[model samples]
Target: MKACIITIGNEILKGRTVNTNAAHIGKFLTSRGYEVERGITVKDNLDEIKWAIDESFGKYDIIVTSGGLGPTFDDMTVEGVSRALGLELVEDRETLEILSKRYKELSAELTPERLKLAYIPAGSHAIRNPVGAAPGIWISGGKSSILVLPGVPREMEAILDQADSLINKNDRFYYEATERLAGVMESAMAPIVNRIMEEHAGEVYVKTHPLKSETRNPEIDVEVSAYADSAEMAEQAVRDTIREILAEARRMGKK
Candidate 1:
């Protein structure tokens, strides 16, 4: 399945907030054999968010969005999604009760702004946020599904974990392996990397990232990920690719 992640926040674009949510979601979904086609960070504008959702529906099988699910004025993710899908925005009774109970537990007021958290797209299945006021949402139509989670890291993690069954319904069982070379440069290994990509096209994904370290003259981390019918086959493919790359390094007089 192909996936698209939308991180809705102007802070992300301005470099004020790092988009760790996209990284986590990408890794989690890819492990289940979903190829993450794109990660987009959009401003908190309603039109922009709606445009992103509408565009994703046409191209991706699974669309996951994080952020813009707060009580503040800037929180407009739900509205954008509703407008994009032509769904009605209505207050969900269950979600309202959940939010009310949460606020009462903390001896806080269920203010008008806070009550706004209960509103969602008319037909969406509300997902409980174990750690926060806003609830996540899940909606499926035909062959596509969209999961909207909170911007908070802990809340997003909890909601995703809780809804694992729904997200992983189409299990594909993918695997990835990483090997770190203590004294290798990414530039020096480009040719070998290209050769590996050509030889194992569509069977394996090989990427090299250069790392700086005080203990080693140069370091390059090679990550190989592959999807196969069995875990053993996937693991062996990555191991074989790593071994081949290392052998090439040794032949070039790099220990």
Candidate 2:
């Protein structure tokens, strides 16, 4: 399956935030054997968020969004999704009850701002947030499914973990293996990686990263990965690719 991630927040676009949520979500989806095709970052504007969602809809099998799910005025992810899908924003009583109970425990009142967190796009279900008050939104219909999560890193991760079943509905598997070389340069490893990719073709992918500057003390790490319908197939493909890379590195007289 293919996936697209949308990060919504002025903080991310303005460089005020590092946008680690996108990276986390990408890695998470990739590990589940989903091909992450694109990642988009938009400001807190509703139109921008809606545009991002509209563009990604039907183009990808899964759409995961992070941020703008707070109680503040800038938190408009839910509304944007609602407008994009032409769905009404309806208040979920269970979500409201959860928010109310959470705030009461903190000796805080469920003000209007806090109350807004309970509203989600019609026909969507709320995924409970284990770390925050705003529940994540899950919308499934048509050709794609959307998972809208909070901007906060911990809350987003927690809710994503809780919604794993929704994302990884199949038994597909992903496996990756890496080998570090002491004196190999990225440029030198590139050819070997290319050959391994050609040999494996669609079964595996190989990439090399330079751990140290090639002009100085050169070191490289080769990563081989595969996604397959079975865990054994994925593992075997990655292992075979790794072995080929190591053998080629040894032939180059580099440790």
Candidate 3:
């Protein structure tokens, strides 16, 4: 399955907060066999959020959004998503009950700000948050599914863990492999890598990372990753690319 991630917050845009949510979500989706297409961070503007949501619809099977689920004025993900989906914003009693119970357990009153957590787009279901007040929103779109999770890392992870059934039920797993070739320079191998990429085309990706080690000479790590319907096909594709690159490296006078 192809997926995209949108992180909504002005703090992230301003570099005031580290955007760890994208990396975490990317890793989670990758492990689930989802092909992550891209990750974007947008300000907490409803229009910008809605635009992103709309643009991603039909282009991806799943779109996950993090942040902007709090009770603060700048938390506008729900509103932006609702506008994008043409859904009316309404108070969900079930969510209200969940919030109310949690607050009562802590001997705190559910103030208006806290009550904001109870509102969601109509027809969407709330994914209970075991770690925080704002429950995640799960909305089924025309062609794509959306999961709006809280910005808090711990709470976001908890919600995702609880969503295994949904994610697995909708996605198909693909195989991917990575390899790092030592004692090579990326520039020297560029011609062969380019040829391999063109030869493989959509079947796989061959990338090079230049690295240095104090104890050894500068080297290039070549990572070959492929995605296919079957694990064997994916692994074999990567192995073939690795062999081809290594042969070219040897031909170019590498010992």
Candidate 4:
């Protein structure tokens, strides 16, 4: 399965807050064998969020969006999702009731701001957030699915952990992993890695990201992934493949 993560918040873009939401979730999805196509952070502008959601459908099968689910006026993910799916924004009764209960639990009165958490797009399933007031929205498009999550890192993580069943039910994808290889040169390793990949083309990905340095020293980081039915199998494949590359490099050094 291919997925994209969109982290919504002007604060993230302005560097007021660290945008760890996308990066964290991307790693989560990647570790589950899903291919993460792109991870981006956009401002709270509904149009931009809508556009990103709409565009992600064309490029990825699943889109996981974070941020913009709160009682604040700036929380616009629900409306943005509505526009993306061509639906009307309406208060979901069940979600509203949940929010009301949360307020009561806190011995606080429900205000208009708190009620804002109840707005959900029509025809979308509400992802209940037991730990937070804002309920997330889940929608299915033609061939894509979108999940809107909270901006708070802890809340989003809580929902993700408790909602593993929902994620697993979405699609069937195999194993993939990425490791940082910061001490190698891509030019010196490309031919050998390519040869290994040619032997296992259908199930493995050998990606190298070269870190650009103004310093005289440079480093290339390599990430290896193997696709299989189980994590153990995939992990083993990656280890064995990496071992072969390392062994070959060692032998070459001796020659």
Highest lDDT scorer: 2
lDDT of 1: 0.87
lDDT of 4 at 186: 63
Ranking by lDDT: 2, 1, 3, 4
Give TM-scores for every candidate, taking all chains together and pairing residue i with residue i: 0.91, 0.94, 0.90, 0.84
Model 2 scores a C-alpha lDDT of: 0.90
Residue range 1-255, candidate 2, lDDT tens digits: 899999999988889999899999999998888989999999999999999999999999899999998888988999999999999999999999998888899999989999999999999999988767889999997778999999899999999999898899567788988888988889888877887788779899888888899868998887888989998999998887787778888899988
State the weakest 10-residue window (summed lDDT) of model 3: 169-178
Ranking 2 against 3 by lDDT, winner: 2
Off by over 4 Å in 1: 104-109, 213-216
What is the Å distance of residue 140 in model 2 from its true position?
Answer: 1.0
> Candidate 2: minimum summed lDDT over ten consecutive residues — where?
240-249
| lDDT over C-alpha atoms for residue 71 of model 3 | 91
Please list all clashing residue pairs in model 3, or write none if there are none: none
User: Candidate 1: deviation at residue 20, Å?
Assistant: 1.3
lDDT string, candidate 4, 1-255, tens digits: 888999999999999998888888887887666788888788999899988977777678778999998877888888887888888978899988887877898899889888888888777778778777777777766668787889999889877766566566433445544544444566766898788889989777787777755233546666777767776778788888777766876665621
Model 3 scores a C-alpha lDDT of 0.85
**Candidate lDDT (C-alpha), each:** 0.87, 0.90, 0.85, 0.78
TM-score-based ranking: 2, 1, 3, 4
Model 4 spans with C-alpha error above 4 angstroms: 105-108, 170-184, 209-221
Q: Estimate, for each residue in 84-125, the C-alpha lDDT of model 1 and write its tens digit.
A: 998998899999988888889899999988988898888788
TM-score of 1: 0.91
Which stretches of candidate 2 lie above 4 Å from their native place?
A: 102-109
